[model samples]
Target: MAHPLELAEPNVIDEELIRNCITTVEEISIAEDKKKEMKTETELHDIKAVSFSFQNILRIDNLNGLFSLVKLQLDNNIIEKIENIGHLVNLEWLDLSFNNIQNIQGLDTLTKLTDLSLFNNRIEELKNLKTLQNLNCLSVGNNLIRDVVHAITYLRPFRKLKMLNMAGNPCHKDPEYHMRIVAHLRDIVYVDYRLVDPEKVQQAREQYQEDLFEILEEEKKQAEDEKKAEDHQQWLDTLSEANLSGVDTLLKVMLDEDPEQGKLHHLSFWLEIIDEIQHEFKGMSKDFIDNTLNANKAKYAEKERFIDALRSSRQKSDGDSIALVGKFDLKKKKLMRQLEDLREDETVKKLRELQDLNTELNDDLLELGLRQMEADDQIVSDFERRYGDLVNAFVEAAQNGFFAKIRDLENAFHTRAVTMATDELEHFAAGQLEDVTDEAQIFLGDKDIVFASLNASHDAHLGIIDGLEDQIVTKERKTFNTLVAEARAESHTRDRKRITEIATVTARNNKEIVELIQSEQEGWNR
Candidate 1:
């Protein structure tokens, strides 16, 4: 038999551990401000910075959920693999030094990482970190890099990189390690832990003239691309500031400008999202209608047939008209109660689903807006893509209609059924008051009429539902088109205003940049 402690999970990062860590951290923050009271980030979504550095952590697991983590410290652990940290899209600083990790593989989604330290690991090569374009400080010293020159080249794409450390590797002893690696990179301010000497940098560049020229050319291209990206981003910021970022506005602009681009790509993204919401709601609606029909149809048929048999049977009743009316009233209450359930329960459920769908639509669109820039190629790309899905999405969205109309129609059916059933009972009860006929036969006769009325109402409600599909579709299309047209008119004025504002701001910022550059150099000397 295994020991109790050994049988349990050994190196798991569980909720209890996380709660302790987060609460301790929050207490420290709370000391500064009473309102900064920490909530347990067991889900790991709210915490901005954390350290699991000295923990006896063997693996990086149980760290799922959308992490808003900005800085994480996991150094000095027995970790051998770099896994389960990709959801940290906002992660910028990470320290995994002094570990048994052999590779730098799992850091793709960390595009915003600016500072990373993976020193004193078993890392053989410095590849697969290209996604971290924003990286400026990298420390991979004491690693297993076999070729310093080849490894240095991997840092070429990261033009923003300014610090590097390969001090304790095998290639650190290479005769050309200092000169060649230094020459290959342009913007590096520090190597290992020391400031780069200007005189030594010049000598190294001269020593490796041919290689330095290629490196310099590559750096030049990188600069140009960076500038292009900057300008594009500035334009995006201006567009956002102009207050023209709603889905309706975005779709309308794409639809209008698509002809010039000769592609329908941007419009299609909008269409796909709308279509998804529409498809989901339509599916819910269909299932609800099917269940309602299947459940109530049997009830109607059975009750109608039973009442028919009861009316024709020779069962005797000596009760007078008052007793007969009482019996009819009892039947009336039961039938009304059934109708109440049908009206309230099913309709309320549908209404709740509608509310849920509205919430879902808002959340989906919000996420799409957030993730949009990653896929955006300036303006939804060239106009050569398919428009079929786009058109379908719009049609579907128009038809989905929040399910309010459907719910109303459903209530109408239940109300009508109840009204008809009760009226028939009342009419029969009145006949009893006027003439005390064979009470059993009369009551059965009235019940037979009630079931017949329900059966007819059920058929009519189904017919109304069948016709509802086209009615909502037509109404929603008209509503969507009218809104789009109004938005188009509003956009015209906003476009002219946006152009003027952008031009003014660009000119002012350019002047400011020139002044800031001179001041920056002056400030650096101080």
Candidate 2:
């Protein structure tokens, strides 16, 4: 562990720093130790990246010769302006974040750029990005952008864009910004670091479809108009061809009675009229059931089937919750086992190893001290001076230097063991935290799914009930229309007069029914 990066963190962009970084191989991280070494040989035309980040640089400079550079990281600097890098036409990824850039300029030539970040800057408006047609990601977060309309107007062109982060901006404070972004940019996958839900996107488009229409470019507008025209044509065709069982046909006939009055509603709003007519039509809710004070016996049976379905769906959810709980229990038990192993087994084993090492060191020290003392005695007592003096000198050198060396080595060994143990514990803790967080999120997501499914089932059952009522009303309307047609056709004498009387009575009855149903519907809606 020694860090090889510069200590002074030079605040200026210069050639020396550039050359050193390009020539020296970046040290591999733990996660990347198995990967091939990064080639740092400075080949000007072949270089792919120049990382000048976290250099305390005040400005971007000295990047003149690197023509093939694709990634340039110049973030975390105080650079006040974007300049002198327009020659890097091959650049695809550029990050000049944590700077003071006010206006988005000098990037018009970078048509191949796909990702760009000017986060934490002073940009007030989003502009000068008409040429970055290939961009798929953009981040201008924590900036000074104020007008959402202006920002969206500029961002809408790059149709290839999928990810956008404009969080921490003044304009993002408004909740409508999120809705508007979803409505206008339907293709984006992520906005402000959150996934764009398709359901929300549909609702937003419906809410703001009119506004979105006016701002669409000519080509897009033409495409939309063509689609609408095609759909409208299909709707007219369906009206003519459909033997509609419901009041859809009857309502059209009533509305079309006056030749001067024509269709004035879209298909969606026209459904409301059908609904009102269905409600006003008499004997609508009575089905094949026999005449009794009650009409819901068959309906109740239908509901029972739906209830069974709902019950089955809930049972499945319950089983999943049970499995999830079991998983949680297993995780809890596994964590307990891990704690026991770490605290009681592994910790004790490591402590014992350290104790044994200390004991061995002390034993060696004691033996050396005894040998030195014995040599000292022998030299002082009767012995040949040459051998005794040689033994004495050897003993003294071993006593001081050997003891200090052994002590230093022992301390180093202990330090290494402690560091390794701590690293292992920290890694284990982080992994466990991640696992728990994932489990929590999974459970939360499952809960959302469960609730959403249950609600959908309820809505579906209610719809089935309404469908049965509509079917009964449709049968009634069909029968009445069939009888009227037969009665008019059968009359050979004064057929016109009879048809006129029958039509007049039908129109009056339809008028009174429409009024009553409209009142009921208004009150019900309120």
Candidate 3:
């Protein structure tokens, strides 16, 4: 008397609705079965696959009983996370493509999974997949993945991965991307839906092996650079804390005495102090320049090594074709066919175009570096000119009435000091002199240490300014590197696209050639 069960309508999926749909299917199966044993509720529990794609399902819940599930299709849905799928221990195929998922998770129990399609998702990394040892085919194309090398490293544990589709990801556009992936994932038979050419794989492995040492060296240099930066920062902090301690003691000794008595000190005594401070500052400037030049030299040497490695790799690829053929034991017929194809193909043409573009980009990058250097030089020149003007102004002002104004100011303070105790008067005079020394340090610090404590303070301020300028340069360099990376990625992407197009056209041409060869053989047989 009950109404016959039917498939659920395209509505929000819930636990009760899913159960009802399962029960309905079971009832239908029972009605269709002729044998009594086959018409039991046990057949309902054996359901292995479920398709809820485009079913307006907002959440994946209440499927605790479907333990026998092997396949689940939730593609083109509004699902945002991979949740509640752990109960499907036998799951083999999962299609969550065209969803909103960001992270790959909740599949630790599904060790039997072999095929997974997560294309067109928000996945930025390939982590949290360590337990899926049985996974073989993975499609994560059209995602936010960058740094193909790092992504490949994440996938290194999945040795069983034979087919990987990473096309349409930003990483797909990296230079030598195909070679890198093939070299890393040696067992992968298909990459981005294309058959892996064995010859290409071997070539990639050889090339990668040749450059591996250079890459490691570069990494070591980067680590060293980072450590150097940290050490420099620590040194700066210590210098700032310890700066002017000696100058402070000298100031206290000079200013705490009676003004008339302090005036009796020879000019040579102050001049000697000033000369010592100038020498110290000169030493610091020389050391700074030497360190900067050394760093630049190391950077230039690293770049030269990188360029040499690149040239060596290119030369090896170009000059050793015969040797490579012999080494790989290539068949004569296949080699001949490949040679013919290469002659007619646009791969070389595209490579030339890319090389030209790369040359132009390199020129631009060099120009940018030169411009940055020029800007830095200009800033230094401006700072020096401004500093010279400040010193000249201070000298001119001093020659006029700077000391007279200070003497008049000191006389007024002296009059007030007479009304106070001698110790209090000395303290007050010292405080007043400290203020004057601070102002004088701005310009005279370079020539003399009349305001030696103030000079240290000024140097600390300059150090902070220098640090800021360095940070600016570092930021600009990072921006330039990013721009260069993006340009190279774009060029590589274009090259790959052109190669794919040419390959498609060549396949058709090869088909025609095959048909003609077959026709000629048939005629000869006749």
The number of the candidate with the highest lDDT is: 1
lDDT of each: 0.59, 0.57, 0.57
C-alpha root-mean-square deviation, each candidate = 35.3, 46.5, 28.4
For 235-290, candidate 1 gives per-residue lDDT tens digits of 55643332112212322332243332221121113345435434544565455444
Give me the displacement of residue 519 in model 3, in angstroms.
93
Sort by TM-score, top down from the best? 1, 2, 3
TM-score of 1: 0.41
Model 2 quality (TM-score): 0.38
For candidate 2, write residues 1-526 as lDDT tens digits: 2122233454666666665444222333433322223343455677777677777677677788889888888887767889888999999999899876888888989898999999988899988899898999999999988888788777877799999999999998987898888888757899988999999999988889888878766658778999999997775564332212332333233334423122112112234543554454322212211121132243334336544543454355446534543554454355435534563445444434433443443344344434433433343232223323433433343334332333343344334433543443344445532333443344323433433433443344334334533554455446445633543343333334434543454345345434544554565568
Q: Which pairs, if any, clash in model 1?
A: 262-383, 263-383, 263-384
TM-score of each: 0.41, 0.38, 0.36
Quality of model 1 by C-alpha lDDT: 0.59
For candidate 2, list the clashing residue pairs, or say none: none
Runs in model 1 with CA error above 4 Å? 1-10, 23-43, 217-526
Compute the lDDT of residue 232 as modeled in candidate 2.
75
